[model samples]
Target: MKTNESEYDRLLHDIYETIDNPCAWKDFCSHLRESVGAASVHLFGFDRQRDLFSWSDGFGLANAEPLERIRPLYRDDVRLSWLRAFPAGKWLHCGVELDCADDDDAGGTTGFALYPVADGHRCVALCKLVDHQRLTVILACSAQADDAPLAPAARALLERLTPHLSRAVRLYARRFALNADALAARKRAPAMLVSAQGEVLHSNEPAQQLLRATSLVRVRNRRLALTAPHHARLLEDIAVSEARLRSRANGAQAAAARFRALRIVGEKGEAARDASPDGASSASGQHEVLYAFYNVVVTPDDASAAELRAYAALTFYHPRSAPPVDEKVLAAAFDLSPAECRIALLLAEGLALKEIAAQVGVQHDTVRKQLQSIFQKTATRRQPELLRLLLNLPGGSAGAAPDAG
Candidate 1:
């Protein structure tokens, strides 16, 4: 419980190190509990809108207890009511929301008597809403531990730590995004993290934006999923094999694995399904959970103690579908209208007339008329001829196919 300049500086400085080494969370949680004399201290993440727990820590609690076992209690826990209504980074009572302290539900949320106590100790929580990473700090008293609220001294110490915690999360998130994007840039493919079960742990902005481009990939049940069975099977097999290898391989061994998820899709979402899976057609649009993504294993290195590491990183190795087309350049080169330029690019990408129409949200006849106009402007009366001309134009490599420059 000692507070000093050295102690404060020490934790503040290690925030980046913790992000690089998640196991640091264990140490921090243990330190916080020791400082506050709580029965148990937990840092919980939430989607307050749904009152769901995104993540929870195993500190001063039953390590073997699964989230489902505690979910019922957490849902009814009164902290949620306030969490849903509280503004960003606001320290709240963890008790009630909108004067609804008196409202009772099954999840043990009693006014002033927050339900999820540790052996009859009051559980206190404070929340900081940092965009999608809403985090809450929960403190519970043990029958033998401190039953009173956090002492002013303890509160003051925490007041110093909270802002640092939020900044760390944001920094961690940004770093993750940059890393994922770098992978995508290098492989020329969208990159994401999936659990051994293929549940998507994370994806970059490009990956999310690609979701609508094709049904081959999707995020469902908070997991990265696939609608195309062929790709799913391939991903599962690769993920499983890689997971096993990574779990056993050392850093050098993993680096030599030469592992990649091949031909998942061209252009992230721009290409047609490369192969169909057996049994179910993608046309049904049914999503199946992809099991096999994470390749976690304990490894030791001289640089530090034993730590968790991903044995394998997943990536798509394929030719990009197309580069973004510069509509203005194409139009200027071909002396075509903006609408004509868009249709020409889609046509060159090998999309059928119907597909192009669907992508552009236009009627079949509308696409036909546009095609005719484009042909007259460019002196090409057939689809193939127009596609060839469009492909040859500058800035015709790839794009969303701007309807206008």
Candidate 2:
């Protein structure tokens, strides 16, 4: 099969366009499906940690029901398990089948059948592990019979598209998380967006004031500089995060290397606190300012105009002034029940299970069960991770969560 250079270029452009304009995803899938002469093409992600499908879009799907139907069957599909063994950027063919088993409680029996084979149609799928916990996939089903094999040229085209598609998906997810983190930290915290090279791209009023009040951070030659002697550690943290972001190497070791918090003193050897919105030191008169770094999304506009292609968010917030975790927002964000939300709030306040149970007037056993449910709902494994997740939520006050601005 002859490959059209212009056609491939357009497809590549469409893939990146989906990062900013998600609705264009359908167009990307449609173009790819037509290019390969396939019946349908799907772009979807799965969160293995949550055991749930994350986001999905497809072209040439007859109706939306199959999308919903596939969700329940995904956990039981052997193809997904088999696809995991293959490396990213490699496409493999598989037949769709569902295996079901009933335990003794439901009359013990193991059953297997070719489910919804649709005349023995076959699919070519490529899986990309976006991170340790998430998997993104592209699947194309042949319009022809199962016996009809995919063309070599089609396979080659897909292989060529793999890296670009993976990058776009990663950027899409990063943009979403960045928006959320920015909204959460922009109001009550002094936050700035800085490039990998330490150039300040953007800084809120609080951040500007904080920079003015203390010598821990300074603008030297139009770049953010950590002047405090102890801040070398923070600078190294930023470098490691940027390296991981640029290299797209988010393995367990890199994730562990991500530094969430550091403490820095003022140049005068006094403790520095984050400046308030009105350009004054925090009213709490906190001793030290806590610095936290996060990998944030680079906007489509900034991606072109900036000297450095990658960036990180630097935030400072006074622990004393940190607002209480909002139960309503917790409920809305994680689908937690009112009871579970209250328990989560208590947990965020650094309460033990027994303390939470006693305070909430619930049995310890009940609190333990609710805590487990909270863990599942939040997709967090431990209490500390849950606390960090709650603290990073996009609302500082009670009632509704703020919009990601």
Candidate 3:
């Protein structure tokens, strides 16, 4: 009795400490398995709004059959009546056994019947709201039955663990909100955490606003879909190009070279930083708007056997509210020299020929010569036409980044 009591106490402490760190689902699930003596453990969450389901820390399920195959029957298990009506801090136990029964009249096996006691892979569970209080949690485990009732010990441990689990989720939400708020302070950009198939698991306010106002791209079933077929094709090509660039020999070295050559997609501002194999791909406004695609991996709690997990975190930057563009973008996009890029920006700012020369610290004739070169390179015949074109360039606002010349 003494040893059992002490072991249970220690397990409770470990579960608490484990979830205190960021992204602690795996560690918490491990501690849960050892504490309950269960064969498997799973943490699930249901988003009522999107009606989406996600699970993590599924122990002993790595080699198990894919959930999708079983999903038709068990995806939304009617047997989880208690789960649908779950309490905040209380642990729910569900176990039932289907056994062959003899037909009373025929004296032969008639049908299978569930035994009174709860029996299943998923034996214990907990739930809470996470991700800015928008997502719900259902943490559960599958512990095999012993002759003696283990419920008391399980309850004791969970009582100690539930509060911490809820707190950890709240902490993650807070961290996400803080990061997004910080970015919004500087720019009117927003981000999303999307599944590989494009399901949006989480989205910041800025992203929501951008989507509501924009028609070129829309969120359907919580996934990003492009309105223009051509735009979608272009984006697909960019993703393919970047992915191929990342797969070559000396891929790391080659990626840097290609990034410099393409002058597109990097963590300049609010880039997808999920750190998965799908890495973040982003595009800010050229003259329209910018979007970021972050790849996320969705590993189940019992990831011992399951596969196929990637997500696309979508981000949006409206051209009307975009941050200033760097000069490098101008030089690359318009194929202008450094001097020409600076002069182009100055011309957009309503500076006269002499004024631009003065600001650029060049002689009048030198500035005039540069202007002609800029005119030819930019395909504009005169200053006013050139100004209109430059002013309409992406991130052409007063708040744009310093002249990238």
Candidate 4:
């Protein structure tokens, strides 16, 4: 039951990778069951609005059965009573042996172990059960039986895995926040990603044009070559604000306040003459460095400046163009007619030929013929490679000559 370091690392790696994939939560549940030699594994996310629990993932449940069948046993059955006794918002480990009824359809009586993750506002729990004790030890949850406390070896394993588990949970939460922000940005403005140091890592078409037409220096491979002096002021302001927030006991409030102050400074400085000393004075003598901005402006349909400000505050800005492709440009680049260009754009966006045909009001064979023509002209053999080429094309015009200059 002693878990070696190499095996532990591999298991941890698998967990991290699974969580990164939005659709792999169910697989992670199965992997957890196998790694711990558990009969079954279940994951639940608390629903505060409905005041109920819902299954997030599972390993050994059938497709169509009501979860209530399994719920009643965990709620009232003597075997799982210990688990039900614990209050929410606390991590609990329970070990108990229960009798198995000979006629029971549920997985026969087996020892159980559970791990709960909670942060006051929400809770998630992972449950597992197995017939043997050695497998339980290898799984690394501390034992809570009154008759036998967790052994020294098992306790050591739990201690080692605790940090990793906590980090995994935090990473999941962070990903949720990022995805939410990205979706919001998609609705408002072109979003771009930048490194913490203000280097542009990605820009949408609109953002790229905006930066290049402005005073920013464009470098090879689509990177912006901004001098340290250019970004020094913003970096200094961020550093000072971060230092102040860190020194405060109420870090969260202080951090928010600092961010507001920085935003005001950014807005004021944004209007100043480009590369002027007045503009450079906004960051407390720190030079202007590259920064990410999510500019939410009102269109002709929306005229309220207040509404526009609200959108800007909530939306994240990046320097990227929307992912839409121009049909005329695509037709010229691939030497296709307008109809063929439309199909090619659909294919580039990962639609199957049948789906494209349905959307475009064409036969599937016609779509296939168009794809063949695209392949010949683009000299690409696979869908993935063609898609990549489309994405990397500058100005997003399919017909634009390749950047030879």
Instruction: Give the range where candidate 2 is weakest over 10 consecutive residues by summed lDDT.
Output: 105-114
lDDT of 3 by residue, 80-139 (tens): 322333345554444322121432222232221111124333333333434323456556
**Residue 40, candidate 4: C-alpha displacement in angstroms:** 2.2
Name the top TM-score candidate. 2
Evaluated at residue 129, the lDDT of candidate 1 is 28
Q: How close is candidate 1 to the true structure, as a TM-score?
A: 0.35
Per-residue lDDT of candidate 4, residues 1-405 (tens digit): 435776577657766775556456566556654544434445443222222232245566433222433333343245445543333222333332333343243224333433221211111122231112111101222211232433445344444555665555445543322222223223323344433244554544455444543333344554444344544544444444434334443553334333321121133233224356654433443333334443221122222332221111211222222345556556656687777677777876778889999999989898888788888887988888878777655443322222221
Give the C-alpha miss distance for residue 105 in model 1, angstroms.
17
For candidate 2, lDDT tens digit of each residue in 218-276?
A: 77776878745535655565566545545556472346345466565433334444455
Which has the higher TM-score value, candidate number 3 or candidate number 4? 3
What lDDT score goes with residue 74 in model 4? Answer: 41
Q: Show model 1 residue runs off by greater than 4 Å.
A: 47-52, 63-79, 93-113, 118-121, 129-146, 174-405
List residue ranges in candidate 2 displaced over 4 A.
1-198, 203-227, 230-262, 266-286, 292-326, 357-405
Q: Relative to the unseen true structure, what is the C-alpha lDDT of residue 276 in candidate 3, on a scale of 0 to 100?
A: 47
Backbone steric clashes in candidate 1, count: 14
Candidate achieving the largest lDDT: 2
